[model samples]
Target chain A: MKNIIIASTSTIHGSGYLDYILEELNTFFKEAETILFIPYARPGGISHDEYTNIVKTAFTKINKTVKGIHEFENPVEAIANAEAIFTGGGNTFVLTDMLHRNHLIEAIQNVVKNGTPYLGTSAGSNICGLTIRTTNDMPIVYPPSFNALALVPFNINPHYLDPDTNSKHMGETRETRIKEFHGFNPQPVVGLREGSWLRVSGDSIVLKGHLTARIFEKGKSPCEVEPETELNTLK
Target chain B: MKNIIIASTSTIHGSGYLDYILEELNTFFKEAETILFIPYARPGGISHDEYTNIVKTAFTKINKTVKGIHEFENPVEAIANAEAIFTGGGNTFVLTDMLHRNHLIEAIQNVVKNGTPYLGTSAGSNICGLTIRTTNDMPIVYPPSFNALALVPFNINPHYLDPDTNSKHMGETRETRIKEFHGFNPQPVVGLREGSWLRVSGDSIVLKGHLTARIFEKGKSPCEVEPETELNTLK
Candidate 1:
């Protein structure tokens, strides 16, 4: 059975890194003594070592050691040998570009599907979808392809925010962007609000958290689904 | 000599479509009797005819006729013979994809370089840069390449927003996103606020509109430049 926790973000507002979800992660990663961290996203252009150190500090709270894939000679081998894997948030395009360039996409996908416990937050969670078409991040760098792990049947719009009726900004809302994605893409999209996550076990993908998630399908009106809902039925 | 007006948006809040810039546009396109409209962006997933009709109504006020390039049997020829060209805002990925698919990138570049009057708003303005790497739009579709017109020396981040100091949202601020772009891209970027534009006349690119534009250059602190400032010195 596949075990995974795909979170909208690692840190919520007014919270430390991964602090809000540390309790759940303690149980999720209980089986593993160490986690192999993929810090390719490099949020805010932080160095790989700096990014990995941050993840290490967070995982330490759960009594688990963390090591960055960059420290290994072969990333594919690192994924294969990892007891558990945790991919942190940053720029999705940068993360995807590095994942493709380092040939870790298939390696990571194979291990995750073959029963390795996995955790993905933000940009990391984005790569678990069918494609990165629904990401809100700016396209700082172009990847070889928009194709992703296909770990889930649908795409994810992380940090999903609803339209503020009082705001004067003219930019497209998170919902509008997803609708635009549906115009060209056929996959269903989950607008994952902060503090929300999808718990995947075997063939079951259940939404978890107190807030509701906005579900978007091609040619259909977007609807809201409550927590504990089965998202695998979206397709 | 290049004559172009690259706007941050087509409409400001509480305003009709192109209402604010119509007066300036009237004087800008005084020499042209007809405007060839490229409605490939398709904001809100509207059809080409519908998007073109909106532009037609706006241009009619200036005593100019508007025809969508899609109406032509040969789009390449349509660009070569047009008196003036206008590309409106929508999804940047969609617009870039169509521009590449129809092989109009080179055609548009040629005509514009040869002194064809050009106007681009939002996604259209995005294409006038060196690459579409700084766009805020979601990657609804993959284009053949990120390379753009290179009409100006630097990239343009249209509809630029300032960071909300009081918001609890954890999403990356606009400034942070642009800074992230600079991490990978060496080109300077202009954050053109709503109602702001870049007026390109020959080799001089001047900031227009009342609002001050934010300027971001690689490895430097972002600064604000007042309207009418010449942006050609960015590089």
Candidate 2:
């Protein structure tokens, strides 16, 4: 039953984008009454009415009732009229190019496979996964490719850092570019640092974080998992 | 058991030391007679007698015979008096900081597990991986951490480019820093593009290359594998 959390930020919004977090996103909408915000991913430089008035001041401090996505030209009927569906965070290839030019990434993957209640932060938890390709930033900017939201298979490198002792910024870090992407492809990465997050529910997949997340797999030996644990698809 | 050939380049005998691909490395040592040139990794400004006379002009164009680790004061007896050790590509953190300050990365992994004959071009095939952390320039420069030449378990991002559709370079494009290094680690990458190479001989592994090698993996679906195939590794 699709309960999805997918964070990297809900309040520790970091480097501004309307600094979010709001008590772990109001504990996933406390009880929920109306929380549909989608901010059409800050398109045209910035104006979804200032990112839906910062998601209407975090759903008016948990009172709920927020609606954006430009009052719906039919974002799958405003994400099927919604009971939850949050999705904030900026610039994951500019919100996956406005969720693939408003096709709403397969209608938000069919309203989270009909279970609803999906919430995302930080480039909206990077479109659920399978191919945002890992994302730390600087593809220069393209947006409109749309193949993620598969729920999770690979690609997430969010805000991860630790090789810097002083910061000269030359190139390569983010764990040596995911260890040079395991030298081309073996498929199994996690790196998720920075306060971390990944809930899911129902099918169960926790992994919160304190560090020691590093997985990397190709031939194996880069292991370390131990946050909330539940991930398993690197076969 | 260890018939390695990791190469990328070696022809500076005159003093130039930095950028050398030199005719795909003199057609990869023409017929290989006795190629043993280590040149301790240049970059901090050459002079190991101009980096072993640029490995004696790429082993005198196949006439072979280039010995340098300061003519072996014991690099495990010059990598066990090689029949073929080669290792050429610059700045992989200054060739892993002179093979970990001359301890020689476990004496070149015990001279490739005593099969000897190993050769690694281009940052010496990224020290045969387990942790060069996948090189693509810029650990900025520190070296001597050791633990590569695992023959393959993950880590080797040699040269691999692909972002200049027009070119400006603000950053973030080796496929978005390797899909943000798969969101911080799910593990599985291999973008190896640029004349490519991976030829181990004992347990047998091959993947030469022209194009068509991009695999990602975490939740799955970034396919494309052509070269020589046979690169499994999931454990």
The candidate maximizing DockQ is 1
| Candidate 1 Cα deviation (angstroms), residue A3 | 0.3
Q: Write the per-residue lDDT of candidate 1 for residues B28-140, one digit (tens) a residue.
A: 99999999999999998899999999999998999999999999999999999999999999999999999999999999999999999999999999999999999999998
Model 2 has a DockQ score of 0.03
Q: How good is the docking of model 2, by CAPRI class?
A: incorrect
Candidate 1 residue lDDT tens string, A12-79: 99889999999999999989999999999999999999999998888778889999999999999999
Instruction: Give the 10-residue window scoring lowest on summed lDDT in candidate 2 chain A.
Output: A12-21
Model 1 interface RMSD, one decimal: 0.7
State every prediction's TM-score relative to the real structure: 0.99, 0.29
Number of colliding residue pairs in each model? 0, 52
Q: Clash number for model 2?
A: 52
